[model samples]
Target: MTTTSPQIVASADGTPIAYESMGDGPPVILIGGAFNDRTTVAALAATLAPHVTAVVYDRRGRGDSGDNADTFAVEREIEDLAALIAAAGGRASLFGHSSGGILALEATAQGLPVERLAVYETPFVVDGLRPLPAEGTAEQIRAFVAKERRDEAVRLFLTEQVAVPAGMVDGMQASPAWPFLVGLAHTLPYDVAVCGADLALPADRLAKIGVPTLTMAGGASPAWFPAAAQAVAGAIPGASYLTVAGQDHGVLHNPDALREPLLTFLR
Candidate 1:
């Protein structure tokens, strides 16, 4: 197995972002979604390492990254990605999954020097297929996290925000990954902020992303995923859309399913 030492870069706010880089081609950063840290995307990074210099980093307040503030804002997260892009030789491609995809789009809208962008199954509610978060959901999550009710916070996010079935959430809670989910429960608000309260597709904002872009969904994913992906692709001028065969929102777990399309689009 190929291995590399982790590195740290200071964001504009002076928060330290922990990351690892491998391979020797054009730079590509992997941004994982809710409940994920850098480790969750390491396999995908490794799969792309041979063809591109892949950088996987922990988003703020997760894994090895420094958490400098209790308040979560999307701008700060965008600055973190900007700092990583600077570290990746001033400009690089970005690949974000789920809420992280929303963040990437916001970054591009905010004028980050992104060369190419790829996103997988960003959960935007264009057709009202998924329920939008209730007003003040971020504050509610903040209160739960502040009280250290980690399990409750996690449950609220999964069932309410992500719209996972209660029984499925219970099954996940029984799994070994549940504890890790609890550990990162505080960062759920960050994801919520990135996705926004409305959860509607920001067609006007996405249209401003004047870069080569690829939006991907999974054939076996929930009905809303492809719709969201297609909506996003259509919003961004000249952006390409793809559906990974026999995969779902958890396509990151099956790196092989993502590797080819990523290579084809990114190259």
Candidate 2:
């Protein structure tokens, strides 16, 4: 389950997408959530490596990936994946976290060659327990990034949009992960675009996903996460659902709890 150094593949539009693949089995690309690059999902990728060919990649505008487009659109991200899948012999399973989950679903719904799909804590605001992002939140984040205020952008996105408590964000800022979050802040708008401003689920797209799908949430997460995950599973006909006990949104860092479910589903 070991991996070689990272490599590059030219995505559609010639954007060089950096990725690393571990093991040898049915390929499963791991799409990381907002404020995350490939390294953020390294733990989960390693966990699944022995069971599946886990592919971890840096999405455009983050890590070593090239951002060729002037405007950030979800379709471009899909095309980046399209290229990656093509490299994986034209078909591969997918695993996305949070906003990355939304992107993966969109790719599958749009008729990509996805063999299977699994998403954790997709984070749609299905229930009314929490308020949606205020209008222009995305714009504000974009402005912060444009102004080279990466730290500010990260704080705003986490506290205001992702609903992480302010104090929690303060602690995160002091953690080692804070540097990565700040480094990837320029891509926050790409995440915001994937997760619509209101954080509403796209029922039409979910209905179009015909592949086997697994939607999961952490039991320890706020009440709305499981609700959102269930709604996602319910939307895709015959999709499976799970709530991993004692896990939460930060499960990416300590993802051993996900190994069994991921192996059972994607293997």
Cα error, residue 255 of model 1, in Å, equals 0.4
Listed in order, each prediction's TM-score against the native is 0.97, 0.96
Tens digit of per-residue lDDT, candidate 1, span 159-261: 8788899999999999998999999998999998899877889999999999999999999998899999999999999999998999999988999999999
Candidate 2 structure quality by residue, lDDT tens digits, 1-267: 124467899987999998888877999999998988888888888888887888899899888789999987999999999999988889999999999999999999999999999999997988696888877898999999999999999999998789888999999999997987888899999998898888998987899999999999998999999999999999999999999999999889788998999999986
lDDT assessment of candidate 1: 0.91
CA error at residue 146 for candidate 1, angstroms? 0.9
What is residue 180's positional error in candidate 1, in angstroms?
A: 0.9
CA lDDT of 173 in candidate 2?
92
Task: Give the Cα lDDT of each candidate.
Answer: 0.91, 0.90
Best by lDDT: 1
Number of colliding residue pairs in each model: 0, 0
